[model samples]
Target chain A: MDIKNILISVDASDNAMRAVDYAASILANAEGVRVTLLYIERAPNRDKFDDEAAWLNQCKLDHDRVFDFLKTARQKLVAAGLPEASVHERTVLCSAEPSIAQTILDVQQAEGFGTLVVGRRGLTKGEEFLFGSVSSKLVHNAKNCAVWVVQ
Target chain B: MPESVRELVERFKPPVSVRTYGTVFTDTTEFMNIGYGDVIKLGGRYYLVLGDERERRFGMEDPKFWVKRCVEMESGQYRILKLEFQESFDQHIGSLTITCHRSAAKEARILRLVAGDMRFMQGLGVRDERGNLARVLERVAGRRLDLNIEDLHQSHREYFQETFPGILQRFIGACRAIHHLHQHGETHGDIRRDHLYVDHKTGEYCWIDFDYGYDSVENPFGLDLFGLGNILSFITGKGVHTIQDVDAEALGITEADCALFFRHRVVNLRKLFPYIPADLNNVLMHYSAQSEVFYESVPELLADLEPCLENLRRA
Candidate 1:
């Protein structure tokens, strides 16, 4: 019941920023509370023109973008009064083999975080039907850890 | 057995025991409250008795004026009639009444063409002398489908698939009705999925609402066709639900992407549904296309749609 560790999944989206803001507001001055910002690089599916080099280049670009997003998120938390020492950043390249959702859950289990903070990109009913969302998957799958999905 | 005149007359008189007709509309939350009306039955036929005495001093000048005018000007079965509430104080508190006619398949076709009953609720609409309005809708004896498109798509997906041929037929029927409007030098300016109605029993489609319609416009039927495109996409996609729900960011459909549509760069529906028929996707693309390269006339659109519908029906 004690708030100790919080893992937030960051993306280059307003919703992701909103999640960070939510975590910062709730855990701003809480004693011993630590924040881990996790950025997952979902492996891009290859098309006809996309060779190994092109795929790697795209990954590198995505990594840099996500890295920058993570840095901004950390700065936001520190500014909100959480100690810089309490904030941590983690990144991983999730191959399509395990699925993006499974990768997220795997990391959550390994780290043993108490709470997972994730942003919900509002998908349409049709979109949701075709592709089940990551936040939804985590909430349903992660039974032990508390998952807060900020829209 | 039909009721006698004496029985019908007695039914309309005093105690106002018309409760068994349909139901008194106490819940006006979902209803359009222009005036109060009781859905009553007489002589085995249904009638709506709409009453307003608020403007009695001013000659009860609303539906009474329009009803009187319509009776004088238009011939045949008058949709409005003067209801005498003998016990009521006012000498001339008139009720606009409409007789409900059971529309057969043949009648539904003619109704769609002549009545413009597609957009509005199927009913007899009466406006006051000052142009205020009230409607006495026909009692639909058959099942009424869900009002919202989202619910219809979600709940009736199987129905749509099973009766897709018939659905396509109705789609063409709507297009034909639009064609009729265009032929008369009129335009249904605001054409959307909401304006189109489908009869659950008859599978008939009607176009309603001419509030935004006009006798003539600068653009020759293009906007209506564009609206038809929107309707087609709505049917194919089941329903998009809301504009905000659109994957605008993912589909690159922002203001920057607006130019792509204008440049004849088509957005495939198959991208949303990979197994979607190519013919159906092509029809969708053609309708959603900005240029006249696809269709300039309703007939042209129909020409394309008929074959597509046939092919889809066969498939």
Candidate 2:
């Protein structure tokens, strides 16, 4: 198989955009390399929050955050010399994955992306263990794909 | 035809066969009992068995009498010498009969594979003079997690809320470690309370002892998952809650609205401790005797545990 696709995990944080820019910069002039902007809409479920309203608000926040980053992530990819035809965006449901990192890996594998690009959230090891960071999990578990964790 | 009379008649009967000649009988086995100062020669090195204070009082009559603490005569470094011990048993879960047996070879295989990996018991498998493969393990100086938390003063509710989350974190880490081991194509096989130790040096729960195996065609690691479930049940309730002991504990708990596990025990912990999060209890229910479906893999178990753990952490 001629593996030529790069999957970038899109997040609302500035660091996630850093990952986008990193992938964009690397594959800017590289031929036959396609880019995918993947965003997992992560939010607390109704049962997780004290009230349904709180859960709805979180859902809205996650929805808006994905859109907020998707726009910039796409423009930056195109601005970095990747064609509009070659760029793809995927917004996956949070419930689809056990963890966000696992979801990204599952999507990457399902889509046959050879390289998975993610951003380092620069969280302390303890914090990462408790809260979990996608970049670290990807670095540890992303098999059959190359993971680039950009700081 | 009474069983007592039949047994009495059999006791008076002589041996079925007697040695007719001086020729040595080749059909018998004489197990050499190893003890303190006993030297076992494995590979090219000799190991002198040693003992701590515990051995002095309790002796080596423990089930794992074959395992001994030793020091390499050449290196002077401490190591655990695991001699082959034939241990096997069967567990009845519904219509299923899970056959568990000891596998020194599997332990040695995993030890060598995960050497220098802190999550697993580290060791090397060496062929002994008897041609049986033995394990020479790097001694991990740590208190077993179960024993460390055995005498806690906190009430079940307090312990469950205050300290369990921390212990659960370590347990989760250990499970993840087991998951990683599974990824490397091996199951811990024996996930027991004593097997998990809180390394005093690193403050991490390190798994030890992997010589156990079972036959489950559907899931090779299913027994391992069951072992993990048993450990979870033990830790969550602060002790094994079998059918026989619930009365002794005097918790005034009833079997109504409860689920029993192996040996008709564990009367639905959610009922006993109502404060236990439903989600967490639901995970435990997978191991209940009444569970229609069971956890097939460690990753599947982890997927269920993550959310409950996150909720607990936040709470």
Candidate 3:
């Protein structure tokens, strides 16, 4: 598959770093491919703010913090042989509008990303039972796109 | 106590009840009369009802929903039970509700991490068979200090001034909370004055409504610092409430402006509040000003703010 855009979800967790490393190694020779790093955050409480203006101010803050992570991802991708300019980063705060996996699928479709990459942290059966894994959810939901679960 | 007798005894025991809270709807159009203290039962599990009129809803019936649901359930790694759209409403104009697994909320992780040092409104997550999700949050008990309401702004300013030291302490406490999140390699994503809540009597405070995502941006810390600056400005009556309140021309900006240039023009903190104290003013300007030397991290900004807070303590 000629991967035009590869969207990877990362966090501070070690699994996310593993996924980053995996993507770097796999895409080392894949020229002309663009990589996008995405991080999804929990959405803010809308009821707390009395109006849209207050909510907008909070949104600005959320968007502002993404700059640092984007820069770091760009550096890693560039060091991994991806063109610096071709690597892009974005962040989304889930307001419970859509489940996290669905949100990722929507972004993939909207942005025309050809592949989705995520880390598969081996969760204990109990851990999985309590907190559903985002990777497994993405792998099943993605249509017409490649889903990569890096362990 | 023999093995065979013990096995027989265990097998005869009643099934454990899976705890559930609230109702699950298929879409926003489903009619909902859900409220706090309501209970929902599915597959021998009972979920306590929670949410107000303004509670956020979650649901989906997309094609991929089936696939995602299957994957999530098949993994044998989740506590989410089998979900189904038990009823369909005639009209779909309103929001859809889902039964959230209590442990599904990100706040649960936060609560565990903070160990009750900071309080947050708790909630449960509701997920359906299609992998749709929603949360059931416990309402934080207190009158909301809605400073953003135009009618309340003046009154709030008076209240803030009357309790300046307390308000300042609360603001610092909030910063400390944000700093804690940063230490764990996380960002609140959305930081503002609205998220801070205080008990009317005790004056104990907590930052509510964790939102926002982390990304690889040029200045990762700039976002929160900018937010903290704006929040401090607002609490201190130094912030402009609206865009029109700002004088774009003073910054040598034009009417027709792009985002980058406009942001630069808008961050004129000195112009907005020239009389602001030098130390706090410096911190605010550096963080809020788009073109100025912004602090690279939250700790660095806190370094400057701590001294200003100490000065306040002495005064």
User: CA lDDT, every prediction?
Assistant: 0.54, 0.69, 0.52
What is the Å distance of residue B142 in model 3 from its true position? Answer: 2.3
Clashing pairs in 2: none
- Residue B303 miss distance in model 1 (angstroms): 1.5
Reference contacts reproduced by model 1:
0.00
Inter-residue clash pairs, candidate 1: B62-B128, B62-B129, B63-B128, B118-B206, B118-B207, B118-B208, B119-B207, B119-B208, B120-B208
Q: Write the per-residue lDDT of candidate 2 for residues B85-183, one digit (tens) a residue.
A: 556677554344546677776787788788888987688987665556677888787888888788898999999989999889889999888887777
Top of the candidates by DockQ: 3
**Candidate maximizing lDDT:** 2
Task: Give the range where candidate 1 chain B is weakest over 10 consecutive residues by summed lDDT.
Answer: B85-94
| Predicted complex 3: CAPRI docking category | incorrect
Candidate 3 per-residue lDDT over residues B136-245, each given as its tens digit:
33445554433423234345445434545556667777777777876765556556556666665666666665533432232334456656766666555533333466
The DockQ assigned to candidate 3 is 0.03
Q: In candidate 1, which residue ranges exceed 4 Å CA deviation?
A: A1-151, B1-34, B37-149, B152-163, B241-267, B287-294
Query: Would you estimate the TM-scores of all the predictions?
Result: 0.39, 0.55, 0.43
Query: DockQ (Cα-based) per candidate?
Result: 0.01, 0.01, 0.03
On the 0 to 100 scale, the lDDT of residue B71 in model 2 is 64
Tell me how large the interface RMSD of candidate 2 is. 18.3
Measured against the true chain A, the candidates' chain A TM-scores are 0.89, 0.88, 0.78
